[model samples]
Target: MCAAGLAWEPLLRLCLSASLVGCQNSKSFEPPS
Candidate 1:
């Protein structure tokens, strides 16, 4: 469990960063459809 918890930290950080990038990209584009 200890090793797994440590492994999860980076993955979680990557996912959060990806979502943030997605949000920023969407905000930059004009609304459509």
Candidate 2:
């Protein structure tokens, strides 16, 4: 259980960071009106 918790922590953080970066990139790449 301890080992699983340790591994899961970084995976969760990576997913969160990736989602945030994707959102920022999408906003930046929008076409101008």
Candidate 3:
């Protein structure tokens, strides 16, 4: 459905950005350095 696809576009973007940030944070994480 076009409407459902449109509605999910922003949600998908948000999820992608969130996961990207999480990935970056995890990659360079130095817990006690």
Task: Name the candidate that leads on lDDT.
Answer: 2
How well is each residue in 1-33 modelled by candidate 1, as lDDT tens digits?
Answer: 999999899999999999999999988895876
Candidate that beats the other on lDDT, 1 or 3, i.e. the better one: 1
Which residue runs does candidate 1 get wrong by more than 4 Å?
1-3, 31-33
Scanning candidate 3 in windows of ten residues, the lowest lDDT window is 24-33
The sequence of per-residue lDDT tens digits that candidate 3 reaches over residues 1-33 is 999989898999999999999999998895866
C-alpha RMSD of candidate 1: 2.6
Q: State, as a TM-score between 0 and 1, how close model 2 is to the true structure.
A: 0.80
lDDT of 3 at 14: 97
Candidate number with greatest TM-score: 2
TM per candidate comes to 0.70, 0.80, 0.63
Question: lDDT ranking from best to worst?
Answer: 2, 1, 3
Q: In candidate 1, how many Å is residue 17 off?
A: 0.3
lDDT of each: 0.93, 0.97, 0.92
Scored against the true structure, residue 18 in model 2 reaches a CA lDDT of 100
TM-score of 3: 0.63
Candidate 3 — which residues are off by over 4 angstroms? 1-4, 30-33
